[model samples]
Target: MENRRGYSVYQIALHWLIAVFVLFQLFFGESMTTVVDAVENGQPVSTTDQALGSAHYWAGLAILALVLLRLVLRLASGATASANRGPRWMQLAAHALHGLFYMLLLATPVAGLLAFYVGDPWGDIHSLAKPALIVLIAAHALAALYHQFWLRDGTLKRMLSPAG
Candidate 1:
C-alpha cells in the first residue's frame, strides 16, 4: 500500500461532507418513513411530509455517491490511517468495524432506494440498518476518544487536521 503522510485535503473534505449527510439522514429519516406509511395507508400526504421525504431521498443518494467516491479515493490513493500501538485483536477489530461501516453505508442507501422506488423487504432492511449504523457510529466515536485520551495517540488528530 502506498501510504501518505496524512489524509489529503479531498479525503478530509469528503469525510466531513459524508458525516454531515449521514447525520442529516439519521435525524430526519423518520420523515421519509412517515411519508411511506401514509402512502401505503392511502392517506393524503401533507406538503411538509412530501418535502421532508424528498430531502431524505436526495440525501441518501448523496451519501451513496459520496461514499463511493471516498472508497475510490481510498483505494486509489492508498492512504492508510495512523498506526497505533495496540494489540493485534484491537487492530483487527478496527479493520472489521471499518469494513462493516462501508458495507452498511453502501447497503443502507440502496435499501432505501429500493424501498421508496420499489417496495417491502427493503424497507425492513433499511429500518434495521439505521439502528445498526447508529451503533457503529457510536462505537467509532468512542474508539476515537479512547485513542485520543486513553492512548494519547494521534488517531483523532489525523482525522481532525488535513495536514500532519
Candidate 2:
C-alpha cells in the first residue's frame, strides 16, 4: 500500500498512542466506578484501589492533552489522500464522524473534571465520564468497522498501516 499523503510519522505515533490511552481509560474507568460504588455502600476500599483510580483519571487528562496536540497537527497537515479521494458523501461522513470523536473526546474529560470539582466524594468524578467515552468509542469503532468491512475502501489501513 502506498503511504497516504498528509500523515507524517509523528501523526501516526500520536494516533497509536491516543488509541492505547483511550482503551486503557475505558478499562480503568469501568473498574473505578465499581470501586466508587463499593465505597459509597460503606464497603472497605483499599488505598491501592483509590490510587489506581486516581492514576487513571490523571492519565486520561494527559491523554486529553495529547489529543489536543494531535488536533493541532492534523489541522496543520490537512487531510489524508483517502479523505481527498473519497466520494463526497463518504468524505463528508468521515469528517463528521471525526468531528464528533474530537468533540466527545474533549467534552468527556472536561465533564469529568467538572464532576470532580463538584465534590462527588469519589477519588475522581472522571469515572462519570466513562459512559460518554464509551458512546464515542462505540461510534468510532463502528465507523472503522463499517469502513473496513462494508466500504472496503482502505480507510482503516491508512491508520493501521500506511501503504509504502
Candidate 3:
C-alpha cells in the first residue's frame, strides 16, 4: 500500500462525524440507564427519559453503521496508509491506538444493543468502553494538537481540509 499524506475526503468526514456522534452519546446518553431501569422495574418513565433514550439508541445504531461504512471505505481505498512522521515507537503506538479505536467503535454499540435490546450481559462491556473511549479520544485529540502546534506537521490540517 502506498502511504498518502492524509485521509481522503470521505475518511475525514467519517472521522469527524463519528467524533460528533460519540460525543453526543457520551453527554446525552446518561438518561438511557434511567430509562432502562425504569422499564425493567415496571415504573413510570418520564417523557424526557424516553426521548433521550430513543435518541441514544438511534445514535448508537448510526455510529455502528457509520463505523462499518468507514471501515469498508478504509479497506477498499487503502486510505489508512500511515501519515505519522515520528519515531518508530510513535508510529507503532499510533497504529495500535487506531486499531483500538476501531475495535471499540465496533464493539461498544454492539454490546449496547445486545445489553439493552437483546437483554444480554454485554452492558458491562459497554459500560467499560465509555471511560476507555474518552481516554483514547483525549489522547487522539492531544496528539493531533501536538502534531499541529508543536511538530508543526500539518497532521491536524489534513483532517481539517480535504486538499490532501
- Kindly list the per-residue Cα lDDT of model 3 for residues 1-164, writing each as its tens digit: 65565688888899899999999999977788888889889999889989999999999999999999998987887755555577789878887999999999999998999889776477766778779988999999999898789878788888888754
- lDDT per residue (tens digit) for residues 1-164 in model 1: 74787887888899889989999999989989999999899989889889988999999999999999999999998857556557879888988998998999999999998998888988998999878989999999999899888888778887878865
Q: In model 3, how large is the Cα lDDT of residue 126?
A: 77
The CA-based lDDT of model 2 is what? 0.71
- Sorted by TM-score (best first), the order is 1, 3, 2
Tell me the spans in candidate 3 whose CA falls farther than 4 Å from its real position. none
- TM-score, one value per model: 0.94, 0.74, 0.93
Q: What does candidate 2's lDDT look like per residue over 1-164, in tens digits?
A: 32346467777788889888888877767655666577669987678678777886787798889889988877776766663444699777777877877877787677666655564633454555567667767877887778777877665667766435
Provide backbone clash counts, one per model.
0, 4, 0
lDDT of 3 at 29: 76
Give me the displacement of residue 111 in model 3, in angstroms: 0.4
Error of 1 at 114 (Å): 0.8
Instruction: Identify the superior model by lDDT, candidate 1 or candidate 3.
Output: 1
